[model samples]
Target: MYALEKPQNFHRGTSFSLITRNGDDRSETSDYTSEDEGTEDYRRGGYHAVRIGDTFKHGRYVVQSKLGWGHFSTVWLAWDTQKSIYVALKVQKSAQHYTEAAMDEITILKQIAEGDPEDKKCVVKLLDHFKHSGPNGQHVCMVFEYLGDNLLTLIKYSDYRGIPLHMVKEICFHILVGLDYLHRQLSIIHTDLKPENILLLSMIDPSKDPRRTGAPLILPSSKSKIVSESEVSKDAKASCSDLTKNQKKKIRKKAKRAARKCIGKEEADQDIEVSSPEASHRDDKSNGEPSEEKSRNSVGENSNNDEANDASEGSRGHKRGSRSARQKLLAEVELKCKLVDFGNACWTYKQFTSDIQTRQYRCPEVILGSKYSTSADMWSLACICFELATGDVLFDPHSGDNYDRDEVALGGRYSRDFFNRFGDLRHIRRLRFWPLNKVLKEKYEFREQDATEMADFLVQILDFVPEKRMTAAQCLNHPWISVGPRQLAPSMSENGGSDKKQETDEREAMEVRVGNMAIDGAKNGKDSKSMASPLKQ
Candidate 1:
């Protein structure tokens, strides 16, 4: 059905192979006739010993090497032999997660693709899906655009220095764009946004062509039409230098350009013609200089400026053009963050209410037993933002009284930290277990002051009551993010740094239905989904 070869025309190690498939018809008789001959030939050719080479003859894709592995799926780097392109084949294993997981994955993929395809850059593109019967029974597979490494590795290489402020701005913009699409357009909350899940469009390799790699790769232009792998390696090396005066100057210039572009729709439309006319005049004047004389002068000036600005902003309108691009990337990250381990995902609002996020990132409302909205995503975003900036989790309670999982699960770090910080646990209610005194009695030096201060700082975000947790829209305007501590990264000393709106609508609707189901089902004397155990559950 498919063939694999190390094409002579292409480089070794990794290269494309051709595959051909007929229209849903196979010569069955030929299969029988060729079986014996094929087996003998396969043995003679040593085909059985081929390592890291396997083929899956789907409609048109022939999946090849295993590219990655998740808990429930294995992704293969595949070839759309008919189209002559590479793709990723995510094969769903027959694990417990897959029996029911495929539906959710497919639904999210299709939803993201069909809903505003133009804004779907952040989300992986699903090209096809197929089913095959194997020794274990039937299996499912999905094909997506092949992406290289993820942001996590990039962050790792940064040594937790966090991405540069300009880069962070770009990253934030992309994430927000993706999130805005998901929340408003798709009515969904990513509910999760971390480094690992955010992937780069190009593969992370020093040997990859610059034009074919990274979120900030240079576009094809007159200066260099084709960017080879060596050029990318050079760029990466240059990017490693500490921020110099020249680099800062270049960054400021780029920032100015970016600020102009983001100066609101009214300002943009007003200046569109004005700026273009002035720029056009400047280009025309510059074109008439004596070629040799101009070239000699240009070398000194261009090298000095380009070397510094290359890391901060390119000659490309990356500073200006990247605003929308960044938003799209952020939106993509937010979307994938939503498609995480559903086993741990709360499918409804009520479930989300009862089961809050990890203590470090939990919104104050959740801590105080107040209501929450899709805006709860803001709290998680803050947590991740801090991590990206500082390379350390904001809150990981591993100290004080060591409580087991059961104790932590039943009573919650909220209850424990609540009393520790507030000097009383009486304000908390509706927990499955734990008396007020017992909760307070867990002798530990809870960082109540720290928690309270942190919460107070985020108060505009997560109010003491659930109804008050900041919405994603409100968060966009929050002082901390827009102009406060989060904003410190750009203006403050190298020490500080800062950092979605989505999944609110669908989550609100989902929450309401789930809540109603719980209420109505309770009245009818029916059991809800079994209350999972604190420890085992």
Candidate 2:
């Protein structure tokens, strides 16, 4: 077993913090601090400062590393002593509001777990929950089965080029099955559905997985006294006082320069669109790297120049090969995923908040302040499908002047709510109509057939009227989903079995492929319609 390092600042060395919203519509503002949850939150009624090798619940779970941190809680990768497995341990803040939110989430997760005893619902399972007492306060800690990277990570692994049509179908099948179980079986509404909320069944890269790598478990060690942020600050100040004035001046200048560089990089990155309409027009070179042509022109015809050219070409070839390998690996991945982060879920009859869903996936009904139901989730699902097929978001509305123009394109039943009698938007009179199919074909360069099929499937779910939107069960049977790799082939028995046996085997295979039990054609109901609707006006 690896010995635990000395307990220093617990917030150091963590990469980007994972921000999980608790279904609040209000925006939050914070000062730029460290990438991890700021040190200020390490106090009474705040985040519980966790250290590696620290055990919780009578040494049942040993902390290994910080997974991520959200506004309400800090998630850690822990080794379960009794279970002999790795688990995600979520330690929520001890504040009253956060505690209440944790209780609500626990209730929802319990209901989900109880409904799906076999764990076939494609939903995250809540393994255990208990109270953890620490120097900060009493925290409600939840233990969950450790899953792999989320859908957003999968998208990144694809280099934002979007997954193939067959792979997208496979992922969509799982998401729809989960949604069907939640909406049809339990009457629950997952108000917030996005790429970040869906997690793959296993890590895309097996080398990083502890279970696959046979990594030793982190064992519990002697407890160390927890240090508060205030104490750390005092110690820091004392150390600074011991330094010479000249050294302090140099340190201040270095910090200022580093801050400026950080701000400049952030602004530059914001201008670079990962997958936008203008992306095709931009050069295919990564930022901060010199172009091949530029590198060639800068070098003179010498032996050193020849070596540099060879090195550059080799590096470029290596990058290309690596990307190709990753795509191939992604194609072979199991494509199994589970819906997670239920901090905002509620029953259709009793919603926790009207302002639900991320901005990109928000339905037109929710934007127009109309009553939402299970169809709201369907709308979000449609948006996710489009994103998976074509790396760009369907609707990316901005604030102020551009908001009305971008939102009006979504067209909903509540036109009178935001539009004038003349059929013009009240806030912004000028509007531009860009049909979905046209946007996919012209802007994203999707093939005509692919664009048409994708739009037909999405438009049905994105209907202005919420009730007309396709249900998850109906989406599972959509023509677009049934085509490609998901298409069922006639069964041919190797043992030359009877015709009846072959038919039964084929039916079972179809059911397994779709990840749902109710595969009967009649179960789709009236929501399933002919694929003749045009996405373009």
| Highest lDDT against the true fold, candidate | 2
- Model 1 Cα lDDT, one tens digit per residue, 121-228: 355567787664442334566777666445544444443434434354445444555555655566665544444445555533333322343212111111111222
* lDDT of every predicted structure (CA atoms): 0.38, 0.59
Error of 2 at 514 (Å): 40
Clashes of 1: 22
Deviation of model 2 at 339, angstroms: 0.1
In terms of TM-score, the best-performing candidate is 2
Prediction-by-prediction clash tally = 22, 0
Model 1, position 247: C-alpha lDDT score: 76
Minimal lDDT window, size 10, model 1: 290-299
lDDT of 2 by residue, 288-382 (tens): 22111011110011112111110110000112137656766676666788988777788988887767786657776776666899999998898
lDDT of 2: 0.59
